[model samples]
Target: MEPRKLLSSLFYFSLLSLLSANQQVVDSAHHHHHHRHRHLFDFRPSKLFVFGDSYADTGNIGRSLAGSWKQPYGITFPGKPAGRFSDGRVLTDYLVEIGTALLLIAAKFVGIKSPIPYKFRRVGGKHLRNGMNFAYGGTGVFQSTSPLPNMTTQIGFFQQLIKEGVYNSLELQQSSVALLVLSGNDYSAYISKNGSSQGFPSFITQVVNQLVLNLKMIQELGLKKIAVTTLQPLGCLPFSTAASSFQQCNGTQNALVNLHNLLLQQAVAKLNNETTNDHSTFVILDLNTAFMTVFTNKGDHLGSTRFENPLKPCCVGISNGDVCGSVDESGTKKYTVCENPEAAFFWDTVHPTQAGWRSVYSALQANLQQL
Candidate 1:
């Protein structure tokens, strides 16, 4: 492929992968476990039920389909690929690391490690203690991008788990938390379907409407504490910023994101108002604010980690017709990696480096207290 076509293809990959049913989210910026979570350092939940796209998927996507299952993706942390979208741990790993130490979900310091993915549920023995990860790559609140399973379908899987007696009603009510992450794949689908930008806001409303239904369903299904992430600034993703040489963001796209977030906030607020009497049920992980903080603050959390180019990716195709983990038939790597992935905010076109996620997590501690 030509240079321009390669860039165009990468851009397409960015949009499509942005909300794949599951992948990476918040990192410690440099995998800094020492960073204080003043609010959640002692707050521990019995189980965490994670849902939605690539942003929170620890390892749900199939090995054959996901680039995350390939090499150089998890090179920074475990020294090998283990189904993470970034170079290291993502939000889910941080949330479940052992005793405030997220060395990849050993259950953060007295907390449970990242739960076993649903695919491994049958074979995952002790690993199933914390909860289950049902996220799939390339999925959304409504069906889009991939046919694997939408959020509703993912919820149905959870519902089945509950029916199988994997989790009792007491755990769901007293100590379980559900993490829901929805990237912009639905909007990507809308654009791909030739939906006019003029109709985008209405579409945002429709999307949020469906999201609320999912949220309510989770509540009805029994989890008392649910954490849903606000959309990150879509314009700041590398694919969007690449057009500006990674020096600026597309305000028009961000404006649409703001609209979706506003409607979502309102809906969550209403749900809380009607549902909460003693303790709140819904918590918003403001990925938008946390992500913006990292973009502006650079390497605030890491001892020495810094993102010189916050909107640029650390791993990329070497040239035309390749992607982050692309490999040639001759068993040669097709992508180039940066000297240090921790210093780059993005790992690939659509996801954050572990360091980037850590920075975002540092900013999100206050909100996690609610969970």
Candidate 2:
């Protein structure tokens, strides 16, 4: 089939699924009354340092080569692709809200109206004086599918900027927070490259080792507080569980994720013990717990976060052989979406919906209080 016709078919198929599902958004806030008072980070940070893959990538991906910069990806924000690998926002956008708000206030004081946020400016000059996003989709600690720079390379870019006097000692001293978002892209790459499943334990060890080194490198860069996300429920990702009809997450896969988190907990502890100022310097964002909270209390959320079948992804290939992004010779779309993206927890095969992230953020408030 022609690619155009294939896309057309997929589009129509998605439309039909949306009509039939008629899912509605689930707002869980009212029942819980879980609002909490503000903490230090609730105000603002001088800078926001980001690392990792598509989950946190803002605009580092090149326009011509990345699907993140293509149509249908950013349909929800800026009315066009703004370099995010999702329909709307990702981790960096949510985290940057705090600092960007501060930048806006500073602009107001300078008698400048509506100055561009630091994220929108180049990572040179005084712009780096505020903050800059360093994430690129399809990137990992090690090489992955895309040709973009990995996490280490991204940090290298930062180091180069510092060497060029883009940031001075005083500005680096003011830098308060750094956000690290790491998922299973490294593992995915290993699997895709025919790395054996039996070797996963060893591979995970290597990945964590690289991660620890990366964290140390960031601290050496003179940033103070660092918050790193634990791996989410990987087995529950739409792509992994699709084979089970999306009804059940793979227990074995989840067990591996548990091991990774356990190891990470120890690493964080060790890092704190070694550091001079140990006020929760390495904070772990427990995405595992947050994801489970939403999944278990689906109905508790306003409306029905309860999918008649939660494991199944709303948008997917017509057949098992294809995927959400697949298309045939015709100009028909192969993927389908739920009636409302807000109602669905998972967005595509791997990422979550904007609503899903909101839920995760709410769950993380307790840990965030210490920040």
Q: Number of the top candidate by TM-score?
A: 1
What is the alpha-carbon lDDT for the whole of candidate 2?
0.56
CA-lDDT, candidates in order: 0.69, 0.56
lDDT of 1 at 257: 72
RMSD of each: 6.8, 9.1
Clashes per candidate, residues 3 or more apart or on different chains: 32, 28
Against the hidden reference, what TM-scores do the models get?
0.84, 0.77
Instruction: Specify the poorest-scoring 10-residue window by lDDT in model 1.
Output: 21-30
lDDT of 1 by residue, 1-371 (tens): 23223223323432332321111122221122223223233344767788876777778877766788888889987878888778998878876763222211222335666878888888755677788988776667776545467889999999987898877777777667787877776777677667897888788888889988999889888775576777788888887787898899778777777777777777766676576332335656667766776787775444356778798899898886677988898989999999988789899888889988777767555333322
